[model samples]
Target: MLKQNLQLKLSQKLSPQQIQLMKLIQLPTQAFEQRLKEEMVENPALEGGKEDEYEADEFSSDDYDEYDEYDNDRIEADDINIDEYLSDDEIPNYKLQANNYSDDDEDKTMPFAANVSFHQNLIEQLNTFILSENERDIAEFLVGSIDDMGYIRRSITDIVDDMAFTQGIYTDEKTVENILHVIHQLEPAGVGARNLQECLLLQLRHKTPTESVDLAIDILENQFDAFTKKHYDKLLQKYNISEDQLRNAIDQIEHLNPKPGGAYDNSNKAVEHVVPDFAIKIRDGELELTLNGRNAPELHVSKDYQEMLQSYKHSRDKSTAQKDAVQFIKQKLDSAKWFIDAIRQRQETLFVTMNAIMHYQKEYFLDGDEAKLKPMILKDIADLVGLDISTVSRVANSKYVDTPYGTKLIKEFFSEAMKNDQGEDVSTIEIKKILQTVINEEDKKKPFPDDKLAELLKNKGYPIARRTIAKYREQLDIPVARMRKKI
Candidate 1:
């Protein structure tokens, strides 16, 4: 079948520059700075820092649309014009500076101290133990198997088979288990324990055996399920202990480090610092929003590159090599101009979007109250700012804003609307906050279940279902009422 039909349907397509702009908009402060550095490195014509006063003002954001006119078609050397790039007009001083930060602004960068990793520390401790070549290899293998949480999650038989196959060490389960016991004796009290029960027992074993410590060990070993489930009456019946004695044993168990490896220096792990893209401050009972200075990096096209283009334009020789070189120079210059313009557009979009959000949730920002946050979605902000919903989402998803309360993810401010008893719309965030407050204030010995929580919220005009309460509770990271119960 042969088909050659002219299609006449209106369709929209994103230009390369538009695609780039969307990607740039999605990046948070830290990632955006990294992208900026990469762009400067990849495009030599794109220079960072302030441009000289004498440089041409040709690469303004207004000229960004001109980049679309450039095509891949072959160009004659005579067609190139140097006058377009070279001009006596000076770039505006305000355009050159970011003006986001002042001299008085404090540096937010934190220095992390390097230290031995958890596994490395264990290996060093393994060296201190006087083991034969085979035992040492088994021990090292076991140490490698230990996760960051300081637990050997694998079974003894699994380790045994792995050693025989991977390490070429034919060893039995008993031998591996024996070597594992040696690993369990390492520092941090419970580095090599297989389970929580084992981990707790290991820590208790290291402690100078008090009645409470011994009792705690017995509770963990004999009534491990009952202890974890907080079955106080069952524990009392089984242990034949008084309330105070049981309480002391429970306290001792609670004090033990369930995750021993967590105490070790985490310098080996990649540290992620929260560099907020926007800062929302209350200046004289009014909300003030400012983008991070790092986001507004001073970038300009290289003047020397422009000069090189000019020199090439004036030269009499119009060789193919010269034409190719000029084309490359023109491409780089266009790219630099587009990138600079993209950045400028990104800054404007971010500021404008965030400004709309700030004003939208003005009550929350002014008083630092989560309950004051209005029911807002991406479309609401998009409609307000006259941008696409996807664009608003891109800004909301990855960006963090520094607020008077704390650094908050921008998405946190947006929540689905729910009607109260009075038929007034309210944010789900407000309901969650209130729900959390109710849960926090409830009696630990008799924590409110989902149904009771629903009733309580209903009394407070929320009228949420039992299932919804449970959902919200789970979302808040609060366990079930049974899990929240105390001795």
Candidate 2:
């Protein structure tokens, strides 16, 4: 048998304005400017510029008295007459006024890079060679198979299958290998090799053959594994060569370009430069902070929209069409006002949160010292600002601030705390810096392992475990002893 039961529950929901405010809080400076432009374009009631203080006096709530007439209608009517109100002839043009646009409309042009792709350049080189149509097809397929690293990752059998299925051209491994040889001889000198060893040897073959070149090729081709593992003793024993000879060979190998396709990176993506949201300057031993001017652009409700609303309100008679028009106008006006308010709120929130962080990490900012950064988290700032933790996180995650030292991400100052020898709390960032210094000063020929690193930290009063040392090393991007070893 099924029985009905009463249940109690609690829930939370975000209003539309609250949702929009959350999204606005997370946008960085450039993205926020773009969002403002979009809102202005979508709502003619919104305007952005340095307008005089007249906007405040014009849109005051007390100026709206047209809705007072409808306040007295309290009867529940069976049928409300539309024609009884006003005639169609009295209605004015209901089109949205776009007086926000300027009369001086000058066309602006944007700059863009004009360049060809890496593969296209390779195809152009292939055209110079005199080969049969099948050889050309196989060569083109191989060029397509080459990765951005300029290495051909496919096996000969896979290439054969690819050509058969896609290009509908049947070819054997021997023919594909011959065409690949031609590609390897291209201008880059390492564009068509299958592996790093082959790539290096191909580059060596292009160099003018000297004693060093010959020795480098021999070391790379034979004992490739031992050379990669930096087994200098084995190489010295096998070649019966002096240390200077091995060093010269290794120098030539290092000089050869490992990534032939790196030159074409500009063809795809240009480097992105950071635009900081806040700037700090140390004046007279005191710090001054200012938000980027772009973030504080002046915005207000459109004058034409305000005029339209006021005109619609003061008219004596109202009709169904006018009522609908009034509803639409009020909505756009409300949206424009809410958006401007939200922008102000976002700016205030950002300033408060960043100001708290700046004071918290004031020593680090003043000295450009990572060691001075205190242990902080999102909750600390949330508690200080009387906001939720998630709000603090949204501001901290995407925002960047400029300091007297340099531009830095706000998230960089936050770290977990640990107890030191004195039982005083210290930032883990300080521990990482100490670990980095230890690794950098270690003897390169015999780098210290994790256990030794842990012991050294303990001696310095950190008392960290070996596993934690490894974790911190990885965070700092320091390799293991074997990988960091040198001759």
Candidate 3:
């Protein structure tokens, strides 16, 4: 069935200027430094450091008309169009270059590239393989289908159908399977297989066989679910293998790469260093917060554009076209002024909110102790800063603060508090910390059950329910007592 409908909807949306301000307000210190540089490169009106000490009085907007006429003549001589220039637009030559690491720095150069771009590597290898042009094309296309984790998300049927429809090439399932087999034989060994079983088998085929290797393959091929779910008792009974033998076989299987694409990660190199946006230092028993100054470049209005506007205003003027030019110049200048003001506002707002957050979490920042972190939410910060909750959340989400303790995500400071048996409020993070400690010390042969954990917590004054304990355990990715059980 087909349906058509018309509805009128009214929505309040931020203008480009407002949206830019919102983004600016959320940037942390280091990011703000980069952001300022970007604005300096982009908007001529937003100067980075300071205005010139001595400039002709004619540089002001009041003389914009006179400058415009002079600029118009020069622009026409140069065959440059005025329409291409915007008051808020950045100059072309001042692009910010990414920081390059010096070779002398040991951490800067790694033994292997940080991330292995597997799919790209496979395609490169496929190019070296001896194949007919058509076979090469097909193999390349298949290689392209593999993802970073080294799995072909699409089915073979879907791929064949796509090729038939788009490329007009008839590729059978068997040919695709053969190409897949060859791909699996590549360095990573298990990349192109359709399922886990195939992925494991491809890796196993390369290894020298042992008695347990064959058994492990059988276990993987037949009872993969049981093996994965840690149903060791059932498997031991089924195979009549002792626990030590089973462990060895499991180790052998675990040694295989499930995704062949994983191997390529070391060979390819694209890595970025973590840049903390805010810096905090304690001096004279007070914490001082500063936005990183590196991100923003000093910007100023281009003298040429300023001169054009000045000249236009100076001319008592003549034609309708000249009047129109004057109006256009005024509009662009206004836009540029508005953008500069918004950026300034964003800077002030970011400082105000960040300062409040630092003060609120002063203990944690000073000590680098997670236990010292007070329970806080967006509303608490918004209240302190006299801003909206949403605004506070935005600031917290993207920003990072470098404390004496360590660089941490700003959001790590915020946590919901729960009331303990003593009626004292405690952060969920604190509870989680205690829970982790309890589990870490528990006997491996008989791990504490969730109910038992809850009872222990209650004895310690938390008074949480068994269900709450279970939920917290899951959040920590801790298995149930049975799953945690060990020989």
Clashing pairs in 2: none
- How many clashing pairs in candidate 1? 0
Better of 2 and 3 by lDDT: 2
Task: Give lDDT per model, in order.
Answer: 0.86, 0.78, 0.71
lDDT of 1 at 176: 90
For every candidate in turn, the CA RMSD to the true structure comes to: 2.5, 7.2, 8.3
Identify the leading candidate in terms of lDDT: 1
Clashes of each: 0, 0, 40
Pairs of residues at least 3 apart in sequence or in different chains that clash in candidate 1:
none
Highest TM-score: give the candidate number. 1
lDDT of 3 by residue, 124-217 (tens): 7776677887777678778888877677888999988887898887889888877777777666777777777878887887778898788888
Residue range 1-487, candidate 1, lDDT tens digits: 9999998999998888899999999999889989999999999987876564665454554533354544666666567666666666666333665558654677667787776788899999988889999999999999999988899999998989998898899999999989999999999898889999999999989999999888998999999998888899999999899989999998898888878888674536658888899999988888888988878776767888878887787788878788888878877887877777788788889999999999999988888877899999999999999999999999998799999999999998899999999999999999999999999999998999999999999999998999999899989999999989877
Off by over 4 Å in 3: 1-19, 27-117, 127-138, 153-162, 262-269, 295-297, 479-487
TM-scores, one per candidate: 0.93, 0.84, 0.76
Q: Candidate 1 at residue 334, lDDT?
A: 77
Report lDDT (Cα) of residue 392, candidate 1: 94
Q: Give the alpha carbon lDDT tens digit for every residue of 362-422 in model 2.
A: 7877788888889998888899999999998888877888887788888888899998888
